[model samples]
Target: MAVKSLTPYPFAPKDTVDKFPAPLLYIGWEDHKLFCSPVCVPMPPTTTFGDLVRGTLPGIYSAHPDFARIDWAQTEWFLSGQPFTPDMDKTLAEHGIGHKSAIRFRTPGLTGLNGSCF
Candidate 1:
């Protein structure tokens, strides 16, 4: 077998290709209304469930105190009716979760740190 020498592309990939959207996923979970507006989260395709949760939880809950109580570590992520494991190794791209992919987050119950737990 013979090997061919490889060289880098003359132009930066960014120069000729269109960039993916700034926000990579539409992440959301239901409230009393049964459906809530999904927050647009900026994430890379390589991000894992744990990474996404930890990375965005603070910002999301910071703005919406209503989400303050749910234990992020215990949270469950679902896409297209399938559960996402929290091993923190799965990448969104592996499951074809691409731009604007929808991810629903679920916790045991709705309770903020300040709120009483049932």
Candidate 2:
């Protein structure tokens, strides 16, 4: 897993640009078999969970081909091995998610492409 933290940086004023490095998240996602390498994504704390997932998909797809075929609406995300609420409205800072956090993604009831539910 990538080295990351669970604490979000202090809130910044909107008029000022943050100079610190963006938070790095280690993502683990699987469709059929477990993914081969850990996926690290850097995002600002102001980003909402919904926005993060939508924005990150393109880059993730380039790294993990299986990610391309899944229905994102049915996807789930986890943090610290616990289920992260699929509430797309909350920002990372609003939930106090800081630097170096680890996130995991899974498609409900599907394994690779073998699940008949597809």
Best by lDDT: 2
Candidate 1, 79-109: lDDT as tens digits:
8568866556676677667766788776677
TM-score of each model, in listed order? 0.59, 0.64
Query: Per-residue alpha-carbon lDDT of model 2 for 8-94, expressed as tens digits?
Result: 656544422244468766777655444565577667888897787778756665454456666777887778678766568899877
Candidate 1: which stretches are off by over 4 Å?
Answer: 1-23, 32-36, 111-118
| TM-score of candidate 1 versus the correct structure, residues matched by position | 0.59
Error of 1 at 39 (Å): 1.4
- Candidate 2: C-alpha lDDT: 0.67
RMSD of 2: 8.3
The reply for model 2, stretches above 4 Å from the true place, is 1-20, 31-34, 62-65, 113-118
Clashes of each: 2, 7
